[model samples]
Target: MLTIVKGPYLQWPTEDSMTIMWETSEQASSRADVLMAERIHSGYQGNYKKPEHVVSTVSNKGYCTIHQLTVKNLEPSTIYFYNIYSACEKGEIESGPHPLKTAVRKGEPFSFTVTSETGGYSGFDQSNGRINRNIFHQMQRYRPDLTLFVGDLVNDGQNYDDWEKYFFRPGKDFIINTPFYSCLGNHERNASWYYDFFAYDPPKNYYSFDYGDVHFICLDSTDFIKPEHYPNSAGEISSGNAQYDFLVQDLEATSAAWKIVFFHYPPYISGGYQVEELRKLSPVLEQYGVDVVFNSHTIVYERSHPIRGGQIDENDGIVYIVAGGAGAMPDWFLPKREWHTSQSLAVPHFVQVVVTSNLLELRAIDEEGRLFDALKIRKGTNGRKEFL
Candidate 1:
């Protein structure tokens, strides 16, 4: 079967660099091809021209294959068409003429998409899988600039073949065109397919990138230890000392207008495992003035009020959002805390975030094109706190 998975659009230090990724069924004979073309929008017709080709290699896991392609020296804020293909001695099998756009140069305003909990669910009914597929189709209508996959891209992370059957086949169109970004989910931690297919900076598991005025930090949060083997006090898997140190240095060094962090697990959650193993890193986030935290894994959509020192502090608190509804089925909850301002127990969904000079608007839309939740944060001047 034909499959497609994409993301973790890591921006290289240079203004002209970017990383693109995807996965397929069996390994292709050679590398996949990528073509870029300018976007032309007329009164009633839109066209793409000037195809530029790039090739990508496949990383293998049994019969499954993960593919990655990094394109550099591209113009910022420009739209282009791309595609993937398999080349062999006989001929080439093509995937698409999809489209994507590079991030705007530094200091310019831009928008992107963040989603998670899409495919695969153990113990839950197969209906959960169908819900995720529906959401993926619906999300395409918005045509986001970029897409960040929070985690659990597939239910059986160990089954590379399943990854292809479940995720890639359903989202190929979105994957080929959009510069997708990603993080490791608990499901993904069981195998190396995710890492092998995605081109990340050194130390792979954790890295940071800058786009426009925003600094994006991606972290790995799978608790690898067996639940029965660990003591109650043991925590979730975290970025060892090396990753932590890198984050400290990166955060301190960044001079962007916004600092955003995305990971598989939530530091604070009301269901399906509460509190992250890396709670120790919360202090570092607060100290660095991280503007927002995007998390997944609960299969539910929830957002925390601005919090500081482990408590709600509207003015100086960091906004935490759990966009787990991307495709996974929702979990039952009674809302134990006030931090859960908005939630949806209906269809699976994803989030769309738009950042302007004065405000950051967050919109949660479900598979049916219904608005489930929304919130906004206004930026403050003079380095003081601003409330919604």
Candidate 2:
């Protein structure tokens, strides 16, 4: 049988398409059945109302066990029930009657979680695994529609061992059905391993997507830092380069109510690392009136006051949040610069963001289920944002 090895993780869910990705033990042909389920009663009885105009694309020929199947032409803002089917020389295997939700309509209210520095199995003992599970469970309780993983999903840079240890197992319950997008951290150092494991946007490691009233730009921070370590297309973040060029064009073109950017490093923070490439993009971010920026690599939790042109201006700048609290070994305060830091703490936590047509609410929750900080950004009809 085509034994499942990793994932069935949901990805890039849109009005008309949602991708289901998984890894298997051997080369195999795969298929999925998309059905509509309608509530009948208290016991959760629902009908298997089959969907039409659906397309499934699979690579049943490659020696690589990674299988990415996108179910296309689905109804907008709809609910779906699906089952995975795979065929191999050993046998045929099936998974789930899982429920999936498509994108919300524009102007609709939505919620999602943002976090990095996760699944550091080697960084902790068996009991630490419980801490990882605890943090993940707490976030899951919030029931986010999607999740933005800033980076460091595992401890080691390259290998299936690290993958299974830190990420695949702990994330099984929450990530499988949730649409998970990512940024590349130092831990995901191997070009082939990082790119091969988690699926993001097409062609390069950076890309933008829209859901509800928000447009999200997921970037790879290591692009300019370590060009020698990745593909030629991987680490280009300078001006006029592919990544920077894309950021300019992408932000210039987006008309979403809220624009949020995420990457692995903080250009200005008390993190373990900082860089020119990331700091260089701050102007670009502020220039476009990007609502907020999320970053990781510090292994601490910090939120800077709204900053514009390198200064805090509550009414005119974007808030930079450092949320490296996804189970990685703690890297405490390097040194906080008093001018911009509103709050900073060493903890394992995640940020939950709720977006509406007029508001963006963020909450930081720790491993013990404490809400340490909360911020609200109010958006006027003219598209200007201010802290509330």
Tens-place lDDT per residue, model 2, 1-388, is 5698887778889988888877889877777667666554343323544344333333344444777778887887777766777777787777776667789999789899988777433465457577667767887888788998888887876766887777778888887778888888878774576677666677547899999999999887777566464322343556778788989999999988899999887875665565535667888888888988999887778898998888888776888898887654444566445577888787788999999998999999998889999999998877666787
Steric overlap count per candidate:
10, 3
**lDDT (Cα) of model 2:** 0.77
Best candidate according to TM-score? 2
- Candidate 2: pairs in clash: 1-90, 1-91, 223-235
lDDT of each: 0.65, 0.77
Q: What is the TM-score of each candidate against the true structure?
A: 0.82, 0.90
Cα lDDT, model 2, residue 234: 42
In terms of lDDT, model 1 sits at 0.65
